[model samples]
Structure formats: structure tokens, C-alpha cells
Target: MPCRWLLAPGKALRTRFARPLRCDVNNSRRMLSFLSSMSPDNAELRAEVARTRLSVAVGCITEVRGADAIVNCANEHLVGTQLPYINLDGAAGCVFHCVDGVVHKRAGPELHEACMSLAIEEGSYTETWGGIRCPSGQARVTPAFSLPHCAHIVHVVGPPWPSDAEELRDAYSAGIKAALAVEGPEARPAIRSLAVPAISSGIYQWPRDMSWAAAVQSLGGHLLEASLRRGGAGELPCPQDGARSGLDHVIFSAWDAASGREVEECLRRWVDGTLTEDGLL
Candidate 1:
């Protein structure tokens, strides 16, 4: 018989099913109770989620060195070459230059045409969350030339932000969902997702806190739900032993010190039991 999987809210699961994996079943039950007793508040949960997202963002800045795919906060034109580090500083420039020269050389024109077809303009690029308009039907493949250790480039238009806009929130949610869906059909055993600071907040004029909140909520919700489904329903692909392949890890890479500090503080509160009971931290 196939194994079963279940999807439950993180809080509820932590409360009702926080058990240890042990050879003996009774000890596991005891462990669950202990964890339940220590559950954090919703506020704390929200804060922690924000902090975790921030940490992942910071890590992404450095994590690109070994990832299979790195999602870019690309413009509608896919004119990634215009970016400061990629274009100006030779030392920093080569870091993101994928090995596949074609992807690097052609990404701009190819992305531009796709955006134009969708009626998305350069001014509107960061405003709306544009989908990858590549000619290829697959979301994982980008026109950028491949780089060492990195197999693919996933292009997702970060939702242009007033930061708090519902559209932006939806875009963040959609982006994560899209990435997760890719792994759903693949034979690969694992995949990773990395997000840059969405548009609108930086040069786009979006609010920072709201943008941060939206991202955390979307990614955390997806991860928690996906983990449950994998563990309970067995819908997720697993290894030959029948263990499902879910998000092995999700990271947020902050590009600067301020961003990094903000993320770390939130994480500290979550782990230290400073968050509220409702899980909103």
C-alpha cells in the first residue's frame, strides 16, 4: 500500500502532533505533549516568519555559489545586464554570470519580447508581478547561459510594490507556488527557492515592512502546507524508500547589513519564546 500524507496548519500540528521519531511509540506521544506546551503565540509566529524570511534573503546573497537555480528579480525586459554589480564591478560581475553564455547574452532580448507580448512595459515591470515570458513552456529554464554548479535560472518579476498592495501579496504567493509546482512533476530529488527583495520597495517606491510581511506570509504558508501534504497524503515525490521530496530548505538572502540585522532579530525572538500565542510574529 502507498503511504498517506496530511496537510495541517503549523500551529495546529505543533500542538496536536509534535511527536518525536523513535523506535518506541509511547515516548513519541510524550514528546508531542512537551512541544505543544511550548508553542508560541500567533504574533510571535508572524514575527518569526518575517525574521526567517529575512534570514533566507540575506543567505541568498551568498548562497548562489552552490545552488541549482537562482530566481532573479528581473525586469520585464530581462535586461539583467543593467544591474550595477552584474554590469559594473568586474569582480562582483562574474559571480552571477551563468556559464551558459547564451542565457546571459540573449536573456534581455528574449525577456523583452515576452514582456512586450504581454503588454508589460519597463516602467510597469516592477509595478506588476510579471510571469516569466520565455518562449519555453517550462518555468525552470531561462535563456541565460548556464554557470558552474548552477543548472538553471528562474525568472520571476517581483510584484511592483506600494509594498502593502494585495496585488503584490498575490504575486509573492504565486511566485512560490509556481516554483513548488515545478518540482512536483520533476524526477529530481530536491529543489531550492530563493527570493530577492521584491520591486517597489527599493527603486520602485514600495514599503519595506509590508513587502517583507507579504513575502514571509506567502512562503511560510506554502512551506508549512506542503510539508504537511508530503508527510500525510504522500502526494509529494519521494526517494525509493518512499520518503517524499518537499522543500529541503527555503532561504531569504538580504543584500546588506540592515536587512540582515532585521531578519536575525525576528528569528531570535521566535526561538527565544518572545512571540505571542497566535503565531503572528
Candidate 2:
């Protein structure tokens, strides 16, 4: 169903969706208790949303099922170019290189056409790197095309090596916000669940720990901002109808087991107060 924005006096702008995912204050407390008892892979976001759930897992982005959107760690060009390491083996040896190539390969040439449309028709091109579509620290949204079990793809450009931590954080924040801003039929949020990869840690060569830190910080900052807007002290806003569609899930889909573990650890630290907004090291 389509979503609409709810703006009330002295209230934060909330995304309202059709189906009701009820979470009363008591239910929210129970949910929080249940989350704390669960593993770090299923950590608490502290957002206190009626239906939002945070998760970290090791899996391929293409394999993630049921998410409304999946984030692509795209380069500035948005052409879904493979990493050099895989290119060395020749196209016959490897079909895809990084997350961008993998997602684009799975979604077919139509995805590329859509990106090109955004670049040319929509004028999303940037002057960076001798001119490219979708600059660093920003995000663009497109149809998922042939990707199974997904509705949209949020393409985000991460900062290259030697960039500041804020750039990396902005990359993530922009992706999440882009998903929230995407409007489907009748102006509803195009996506509620977003599957994100550990961007820039792969070909961009950012340190794993630092990369995860920036990601966690961005996640926390956005969610916390939402909670504060709702005037949440220890309770989540839970209305009978028109439940907020403000990100039901933000799944951290790691490319490997080790990266998944790192993401979970960083999330756990955030939940335990060991990590803060400026936690990037």
C-alpha cells in the first residue's frame, strides 16, 4: 500500500503506511527486552519504533530476501564496474567482482539503463572523477529490475581511501535516508526494510573496524533522531492505525562471516553505550 507523511503540531514528520504493525508502549518494552536477550546479530537499534528491527548477518546482497530495498556500494559512475582483482581473471573466470557488479549482474542490463536515465535525463551526474553519476557521500534510488524478492535498489557512493570518517558515515546515512524518501504509488515509502553492505571496506580499502564504526554511528544517529522527535523517553509511539513506516528493518548484509561478526560486535558496542555518535577511530 502507498505511504504518506504525518505532520502534527509539535510532532516529528512520520511516515505512515497502510497495514498496521501495532507496538504499544508495553509491547515496545517487551520487544526491547526480547532484543536484549537475543544475539548481537539481532541487536537493538534504540530507535523504539513500533515495528523496526535491526539485524546483522553474513550473506550475499542478492540472496537477501523480502527486503523492500537493497543498497548497492556503487562507484561515482554507477556503471556497475567490477573490481580490478576480478577483472584480472577475465570475464570468463568471474562474472562479478564487488557488490555493485554482483547486484547489477543479477538485475540485468535494465538496471544499468535506469542508472543511465538518472544520470542523463534526471541530471544526477557530478563533476567528480572527470564527471560521474552519483557523487561520493550521496545516494540514488532505482527500480530493482529483475532482482528477486526486492522492490528497489539504493545506490550509494562511498568515499575512496584517505577520505574522512564523516564521508563514510554520510554515505550510509544518505542510503538510508534515500530509501525513506523513495515514493512508490501514491507517495508511500518505496521501502521499509533496507539491506546494506559494508560499503568501502571492500575495494575502497577502508579499515574493517573503522568502516564498521562509521556504519554503526550512522545507523544510531538516524534512529536516535527519530526517537527524540517522537518524544520518546522510554516508550515507542504506537498508534492503532497508520503505524509509522519509518524503517521497519535495517539489515546489515555482510559479504562474509568475518565481516558479519565485526558488524555484530560493533552493533553490540553501540547497544551497550560503549560506542557513541563520534565513536569512529
Candidate 3:
């Protein structure tokens, strides 16, 4: 379970006359997004992370492709947002609150209609979804309907501020598991690739440092679980063991540079045997 985040600088973020070298911070103030991929530093880090089995990327969610599934960080109501953003510096840029709108919009209207129908009409049978509204820190799996590349979508509701870090971690884990469900009895998971965003990093104001750390933990667990399912409990798993898993990729796509860098470091440290002693989360 390697998570990838993709980030880029804000569109309106220009060098200020007074602080010509501080455009990064200036951009952070406008809206949260994946912003570091295009930057030289981020570009290098992205390449470095890719060398590892588990990794993170900084980029736009809409721009992602080849995933068998994608995650939608939804609210309890599972509704979408306008993904609005106003440039504090120049009144431009589109910051996002949730990825639901972007996923559904690109997937086409049928995707939204399916969600609405499930909430308002049929309701879900999953233990996680209690009727129309999904609970916080839980995930529910659904068909993509019109999303051409993805066969499924995992909708997870991240909790607001003040919730336990464990809760946030659980939310991510659930989403990943749901996204990697098997098609039928005795079948491997239908999803081979998956994409996720920074859950609860926006209006929820979840701490970026710990939240991203939790993300790493969740993905780590995902790989471990895959190993256990395929190879059993006694043996340790190699990166190649991941081939038995339904997922070939688990990308944590981002729109901001900070998250991208943070997740990349997490993967790097873990691979280098540093996370065990350094205590990242």
C-alpha cells in the first residue's frame, strides 16, 4: 500500500515584490491543493518515491488514469462540493473541499445518479452505511457506473477536527479495503489500482503531519493484509508478494505540494527502515 500525492503551485501565486522568494507560503494561504509536482524539488522527490514499492505522488485527481478504482472523500451525506477556491493574492485558483465532485463530474452524471439512488431509494446493505448517510471514519464500496477506467469507487467519510487519530487511520484503511473487494466468492479483488486523496485535510482541519502519517500506516497495513491473505501469517512478505494482491497500485493523489512531499518522505523513511525507530506518526 504505497500512497502517492501530486502537488503544484497555485495558479495566482506569484512572487511578491517584498518577498520575492516566498511564493510557496503565499500559495498555501489561498487554498489547499496538490502543488509541488511541477516544482524542481517536488519533481525530484516524485521520481525518488517511484523507485520504492509503496509511494506518494503530488498531482491533480482529475488528471490521474489507469486505476481500477478511485476513492471519493465524502461527507456523511455523501454529497459533492463546488470545489471552490479564491486566490488570496489575485482572486483566482480552484481549491477543493472534497474529491466527490471531481470524481463524479469526470465519471459523468450516471455516477452521481447511482449515489443518489442508493441514498434516497435503495439504501446500502453494507455494515458501514447506515441508510442514506454514511458515518464518519467509515467506507462504503460502489460501482463506478460511467467511470471508464475504474470499475469501482470507495466513498469514505473522514471525521472533522478533534476526532481521534486512530479514527482517521481507520477511515483510510476501510476505504482501501472496500476499494479492493473481490468480485465474487473465491475471486480476487476486482480492483487492481486505486487512487485516494488527502482525507480530512481540508475543512476538517485535520493535522497534516499526523494525518499523512496515518495514511502511511494504513497503506502499510494494506500491504501486510495482502501478504497475509496470499502467503499466510508465518512468513514476512517481499514487495513481489504484492503481486497476489488485487491492487497493483494505491495512489494518494494530492493537489498541494506539502502533502506530496510529506507522503514521499514517509515512504522513503519506511523503506529505509527508519520509520520503526524515528516514530513518524
Candidate 4:
């Protein structure tokens, strides 16, 4: 299938940081074919995978609307730390360079309070970091107050750069798990769509390529596992399965056009089997 790209109008993301949001979608037969070839015996699984839409986009995650939940790359302390030394030229003097800071800033102080409450519930305090709320590779969920679009936000802490790749993968997986488990009000529907940023790809310094690849692999594996369980492959029945209905979309977001292009390329490779269980080809 030929690759196609769509760039959302700049005005949409201009509420705070004005910039164009570029999105790349691939509803390719190649991806379905790969899934079919991998699971010839499980037609249901292949169909389920085909129904789920995965995309890569370039945009400020705070401006992403319509997602049932968005994932935040949070630190262990859940505090939005300001790195005054690092300056993003186009950030409009927004000292919040990291995603964690950006999210906290946009979402208001309420988010900070919620995170602290969540930390207390989890009993994850530690002296090493002066009371860590969420340890590395862990995830927590909170209401997206002040940010009216999404119902919830999943805060995830990833391992530092050049660390255990498995741990990074776990952080992505944990975010998905936390998002799936969110139980919103009766008027609100189950989380059927999620927007995720490249965890540990920024100030933490994990290579963007490696971070996105791990994200894709983890989410793909999750959908596959969910399909298996839903198809009666003999795994424990997921209780939230009925509530969720199923995740219809998972968007991987990049902060800028260059990174967005990189994410799209990575996704394209995954669809064609160039990026696989072992690593990128």
C-alpha cells in the first residue's frame, strides 16, 4: 500500500502552542496480510487486529482531542520539573520543556494534587528520590480536569535512556493497562481511544526511534493478547473486556514534524515486518 500523510490544521493546536499537527495513517492490506500469515488458524484474531486503527502523528499531546485518554510521560515523583537550562526555541518561553511539565502546566494544579493522592494510595514513596510517587515502569490514572477533551490521563514513568529496554517497554505496557482499567462515570463511555507520547524520548534522553519502536511493539502485542483472550484462546477472561468493548484507536504522537516523520517511518516498517519482535530491520 502506498503511504499517505495528513496534516491537521495548525489552528487546532494553537490554543497554547501554535503548530501544525501532522498525522500518518496506514490502513494497509500489508498489515492485515502479515497478521493473517502470523495467525492463519486464528481468523478472529486477525480480524480484530485489522479493526484496530494505529496511527502516528506530530502534535502537542495537550491539544489532542477526542482521545478517551492520553498518556503522560511523568517522572518518578510525578512533579513537573522545570529544566531552565534546556530551551526549546519555539516553546514561547514555556519553561516546561518535558511532556510531564507541559501536561501539568496545561492541566492546571489539580492534576498535581490528583497525582499526589494517587501516590499516597500506591505507597510508592522512597528516600532515594525524596518520596517517589510512581517508580520507573509504573503507571497511574487521574481525571483530566481543566483539560476538557479527554476523560482521563495515564501518567507513566519510564526508565532513563540507555537503560533496560525491557523496562521501557514495560512503561508503555503499563500505560495501556492503566488506561484500559479506567472506570469513568456512567455518562462517559469506556476508553476506546488512547493517545500516547514517546515515553522517555525527551529529557530522559531515550532515543526517539527506540522509544517509539518499543511503544509500537508493546501496543501491538497487547492487542494481540486481548484478541486471543477474547477469542477464547484459554487465557483468563478479562473482566473489563465487556466494559471496554475494545480499543478502537491508539495514536502515537511526536512533538515535532521531524519526530513525527520518524514515527511514521517506524510504523511503516512495522506494518511491512521490517520492525519485528527482535528489533528494527
Candidate 5:
């Protein structure tokens, strides 16, 4: 389902989603509790979420490893290209580049050449996110080629801030689905988890509140849909086997405290179904 902003007065946000994966407050709480008890990979996020209750679907992280994929908030220039160098030789997960945060530069030299092969000139890329379909809201997925610790890289272009407000959710959700859609068990190590950033926050200048809300809602809604059923190979990994949707364990990486706090509160409201016009961060 395309990400819809479906809010009605007095109705819980959980139920407002396309599907009802969050059963009830009891279920939400239970799921939230379950997140905390997972393996070491998720321990910190579990603890963080418990203390803050900011988001049941979103996790804030300082470092990433073992995730099926990680998000890079790029720009037209793919700014902030720096990804952590853990093990360059280790074939790791995937990295979803949202915006143009120069992740390719850091991934390795040949990474840029691979992106060029996708043929997304700035004009076409911007046009796509602006609502025209060169396949609107779609992403170009490619093998990471030489980026260490990642097997593939999904590049997504979010709408230019202040212009395509409605498209942010599309960009976020598309980036994620594309990552999971990558065919092959050879891509296994990182297909089950994903990482993203606060798209449109920097040079794009999106208010921190909008960034988190769009992100969390997209994630929560997607997870619910996957858990309710199963779509094909392109589907985001859901705990259909009773594990968890790789999409559910989202990481909203922030560079500042203000953005961090906003994501937390915004995510909390989304989970609680309390986010409203008056409750914006």
C-alpha cells in the first residue's frame, strides 16, 4: 500500500494502519517488551526504546552491524558519503542511500561508477521524486560492488524539501522495499534488517518532526502489512516465520540531539497513536 496519512479523531493510530498487526495496546506493549529480549545485536535499541518509549518501530543507533541493510541519507550530490569502516573485506549487508549523501565515495572508488550505470541524472532523479514516473518514488538498486561490509546499495531520491512533502514517505518506504526485493539468498546476511536516516533534515531543511513521523509511520505500516500476509521476493522481510520483519527493526540515525529527541517523541506518538496536529515535535 502507498503510505497514506490516515488519521481520524479518537481512533488509535495502530488500528488506522492498512493492516492491524499491533492487535491492541496489550499487543503493542508485548511486542515492545519482546524487542528488549532479543539477541545482543538489538539489545541497545531495546533498552533505549524501553527507557524512552519514543518508538516501537524505530530504533536509534550509533553503530551498525549485521543488519540486512543500512540507509544513507544522501543529496543530489549524495552528501555525507562517509560510512563506517568496520571490515572492508567482509561481505556485509546492504546500504540504502536516501537523498544523495555521498555514501559511494566512502564505500570505495568504484561505487560511484556503479551508480552512474543506473543512469539517474540529477534531473531525472529529482523528476521522479517530484511525482513524475520515471517510475515515481522508486529506487535504483545495485550491487555495492566494492563497498565493504555491504553487499548491495539501494539509492533512493526523496522529494526536494518544502516542495514534495507528500513524497517523503514514498521515498523512505520505496528504499526499504527495494533492499528486500534484491534477489538471492547470497544477499542473506543483511536482508533481514535495515537502517535509514532522517531524510530531508539537512540541506533540504525539513522540520525534524515531519522527518520522524513519515519515517516511523512508513515503517510501522509496512511491517503490519507484511506480518498480515506475504508478498513475493520483493517483499520486505517479515517475521512471517515468527521472527520479525527486517523492516520492523528500523534505525533512525541522527547526528544531533534535537533530531534524535524529535524522532524519539514522534515515534512514541506514532506507536501510541497519540500523534496529532497539536502534538507535533
Candidate 6:
């Protein structure tokens, strides 16, 4: 599939600072500042900008209520972390333990093979969850088990960053594709997938700003495109179009409160006129 790119307008503001003159060394006088002449309320705008930027960076992870299924960032082994030991041990242990019994009972040997095969073809199933041994080491996908609400847990490895910018863009695009691909007779009515921060910034060591930019751009593009497809204005095939089609809703999960707020604000801005050009809301 051809990759889609969405660009958001820049909102950077520039501030100027006065330079000290060497000739004034003997003078104990200071030049009057224009900033002081302005209303003290101006500082509020600067503070608001700072707050907004921080919110944007943190991103969001929502529960996606009423979704068919929620995707978890899994470990490679597919054994979720055990609970009770979660806080002390970390996410891996918690996830492993949470779904271990359920997954082990249902995963079976065939499922394992299928997962391995998919992992081989698509890098790691969940790109944001695992780590690489070194800069040049091969990537690993985090493992996750299936739950009852969703028919299938579609695992895909998002591309590592600092590489081809276009390819990185495609990874986000592919995630939507994966979600769409699961729309068959046996699929659920509303499919929801959770996305992490992606592989570049965390253990993968990709720059945070760049990674975030790519994620927002790609996800926003796909969502808009999907909407268009469903509306019948676009040529793209949407699973929801078919009779008895088992597809509804696409959800992106943010990892923390700050991140969640960022996504929410972005979506709100996109929905309103503030961020209309970005096609994200």
C-alpha cells in the first residue's frame, strides 16, 4: 500500500534577547525594558504554551470503552508477567502473570508457530515492548496473549526509527492495515487496538520528538483515510461496508496520563478548527 503523509503547521514563536555592550562597562546604568511596559498577563500566554507543549509530548493511552478488543504490548515469549509480583518486577511480570493461564491454555502449539511465523515476517509483533542487545542487534517483539472480548490479537512490529523516514511512516500505516485485515465473518463488531510510543525512542533509542511526530502524523492520516473509505467517498475498501461486517472503531492506547491528555487535546483540536489541517482529530 502507498504510504500517506500528513503535515501539521508549525506554531513556533520566536523571542528576542538584548545583548550587553562592551562600551557600557564603566556605566552602572541599565536600559529600560519594553517587556516590563507590557501587561504582566503576557506571561500567562508563555506559560500556557509551555503547558501545551508538555501535554503534546506526553501523548495518551485510553481504555477505548466498548471496543472489541484491546492490544497489549507483549513480551516475545508470550508469557505475560504474573500479577502480585508486578509492581516489584515491572510491566513484563504483570502482563505475563495476568494472561499466562488463559493464553497457555488457549495458545496451543499451532498458535505459537503462527506467532513465530508472523514475527519472522513482520519483525517483532509488538515493536515498542522489547529491547535490542546493541545498536546493530536484531529487534525483538514483545509477547501478548489473547482475551475473550477480541477474536484475534494482531501483533505487528513497528519499524525502528532513525532509518528511512518513509518506512517509519509505513509502520504506523501498517498498523491500521492490520486492524482492517481482521474484518472477516468471524471477526468482532468493534475492533480496538492499543499502540505504544513505538520502537524508536525507548529501548530502541530513536529520538523522542521524531518518533512522536511520525506516530501522530501516520495515525492521523490512516484514521482520516479510513473514515473516508467508510463514507464511500474514497475508493479504499473498508470492512465495515460489507453486510454483517464485523468491524467498528479504531482506538490508539497511550501509555500514561500525560500522553493520554496530549492525544485527547490533539483530537479535540483536530475536531475543532484549531487543528483541521492536520486531519488527526
Local distance difference test, each candidate? 0.42, 0.68, 0.58, 0.66, 0.50, 0.37
Residue 20 of model 3 has an lDDT of 27
Off by over 4 Å in 5: 1-63, 75-102, 120-136, 145-148, 186-190, 230-248, 276-279
lDDT tens digits, residue span 1-281, model 1: 11113223232311211222444565465345334423553344334333432245453332445454555555444544444434434543334433122335434455444434554333444533453342211222342343444544565555442222444545555455445455423344334544434322443334444455444444554544444455432244345412234343456545556665644443444445442211222
Q: At residue 268, what lDDT does model 4 achieve?
A: 60
lDDT of 3: 0.58
lDDT tens per residue, model 6, 151-220: 4554333343225544444455454555555544655423434333443343223343444445554554
Q: Measure candidate 4: CA RMSD.
A: 11.4
- Summed backbone clashes in each candidate are 48, 1, 25, 0, 20, 23
Question: After superposition on all CA atoms, how large is the RMSD of candidate 2?
Answer: 14.3
- TM-score for each model: 0.50, 0.70, 0.62, 0.69, 0.57, 0.44
Please give the ranking of all candidate structures by lDDT, highest first, separated by commas: 2, 4, 3, 5, 1, 6
> Best candidate, lDDT-wise?
2
What are the per-residue Cα lDDT tens digits for candidate 5 across 226-245?
43354322344533343334
Encode model 2's per-residue lDDT on 1-281: one tens digit a residue. Answer: 23334343344765422333345785475346434423353234352431345677677898897689999988777777743444544653334457887898899999988887774424553443224668788999999999997989999999865466656777997898788888766566667678888888666666666677777767654555455455542344443211243565677888889888887777767766565323333
User: What lDDT would candidate 2 get against the real structure?
Assistant: 0.68
Ranking by TM-score: 2, 4, 3, 5, 1, 6
TM-score of 4: 0.69
Q: Which stretches of candidate 1 lie above 4 Å from their native place?
A: 1-66, 81-146, 181-190, 193-200, 231-237, 240-246, 266-281
Which model, 3 or 6, shows the larger lDDT? 3
- The model with the greater lDDT, 2 or 5, is 2
lDDT of 1 at 10: 33
lDDT comparing candidate 4 with the true structure: 0.66
